[model samples]
Target: MFASDRLELAERYTELLATEGVVRGLIGPREAPRLWERHVLNSAVLAEAIPDGVSVCDIGTGAGLPGLVLAIARPDLSVTLVEPLLRRTTFLDEVVAELGLAHVTVVRGRAEDLHGKATFDVVTSRAVAPLERLLGWSMPLVAPTGATIAMKGQSIHEEITQARRFLSTWRCGEPEVLVVGADVVDPPTTLVRVPWADPKRIGWPLARDAKRRSGRRDRSSVKREVS
Candidate 1:
């Protein structure tokens, strides 16, 4: 559940997505009826995997799927919605302004183009590209010791197998597939979590203390949810 303010913003966002988002060709018209279940809630459930008070970058964020949803669900996070297209970013900007989400930022740029410019504690993407290619573009933006969380559908296991070589090359650990919001959302939400190698061993900067603090929050929240 969300607070009163976030719930109101979520409603407004859903309305915008069903109407303006459809008109602008961002979301298909037929998807309006299932917008809450298939799109908004599906994305929002990803917050279960994200830690509190950490930076998150959502790459290829079309219409701010998981990005905007995450910002709404977890106000503790610093969320960046990155999209390359002007039209998509325009829509995102308007939604962020209307929601008055001070913790969210909209950036217009491709993930590949943003290498070395910025990095995040977590990089997320949904319906973006194949897992192999997605890793190529997203992994570079993940802070050393950070993780890339990709929202994948049923074929995720196969994609992980295909991406094994890339994972090895990048020194990433084995991917973990998690199902979140099991009771809240039908079919739940599937996430492929890939953690980068230790920074010192890989010649990158050391991990930040902020991640540890957020990790503690993550554990506490999960405990409460399970109980």
Candidate 2:
């Protein structure tokens, strides 16, 4: 839900999505009529799952679904919208400027581009990819104490099952399926939260890559030698 002070900004964004968004093929024309209930409000509801005052990265954020919407709803959050498409980033940048959302940053790149360079309290996505692939793209950007929270549909359980091997290899804690915005959105929103099993030992592959870069043996070989 948007604060009273920010409600007008949200409305402006919705209008843009309905007009410019549809004209540019970002949003289908059919979706324009229901942009409020189906897109804007639905995305705004995601705020309930996010913590206060956190750095968030929304990857593959086409037209900045939950990312831009969150910025409008929660000024306390620092949001980064990551999209590879120049067109999408263009629209996103324009909206940010028009809305005067100082807290938002638009990054024109894929989720993998920022893997080693940055990390945030939350890495999020909507209709970006399946759970298996999403983990690869999202988890690396997640800070040690943070998580990858993605909006999912009814097929989430199947996706989770498919991602079991990835979950284990990445050493992620059990994925928690949560329903947020129950009172706000009629159908509500389903989210899957994936955190590191042990914050102190997160980023297994990144650690290995770092060891290689430093010309050092990986933990496994080092442990074997000590044994």
Candidate 3:
């Protein structure tokens, strides 16, 4: 937290991962250091896209990347990090407390189970799942005119291309991509937004799995997200 630049902050994030032994427990020892570049920096890129005063919900916020990082970077917005794992959820709660972050809430539950009571200005998550599923679980939480920013790597273009079917069917708006942190993040990234959709979309990423099993849902199934 005391680090000045992204370079140092990334180092600090790595140091904390090792010190906290979170690397060993959550992502395994081999992958922890890489998290500095892969996760933290990747998540931080969303900071620039965030609008002021927006209350955001980050689904599957394992280590509170986009959500926690966004909250730290933008004090004007409120961030809610949703993670079901108890230990991870506690870790986020503790980190927020330690950082003295004034605007963060770590919720423990599967994304599909939590109904945000229709109270978020923005919804954000990183590779939490396929676009179709992620939208289903996330779109409902978005404010009527609110947006969902789905973070994906450079190959996101492929998913974005394929996701149009769902976007159009759901009546969700256009998609967007951003290439910030070009040097620090791999495959670069994109921030996709679905402007307005059915008020309560449930069973998103979760449904993707089920759809696969029955083959009942596919590119065409993307439409039914409303109410």
For residues 1-227, write the lDDT of model 2, one tens digit per residue.
88899999999999999999999999999999999998888889889899998888898899989899988999888788888888899999899999998778777878776656566788889988899999998888777788899999989999999999988888998999999888888899999999999888884555223222111122123223222
Residues forming the 10-long window of minimal summed lDDT in candidate 1: 204-213
Show model 2 residue runs off by greater than 4 Å. Answer: 207-227
The lDDT of each candidate is 0.81, 0.83, 0.65
lDDT of 1 by residue, 1-227 (tens): 55787888888999999999999999998999999989998999999999878988899999999999999989898787778788898999899898888777777777766564556789999989999999888877777767999999999999999988887876777899999989779999999998876664432222322233233344233223322
In the order shown, what is each candidate's alpha-carbon RMSD? 7.9, 8.6, 9.7
Better by TM-score, candidate 3 or 1: 1
Error (Å) of candidate 2 at residue 197 is 0.4
Q: Among all windows of ten consecutive residues in candidate 2, which has the lowest summed lDDT?
A: 211-220
Candidate with best TM-score? 2
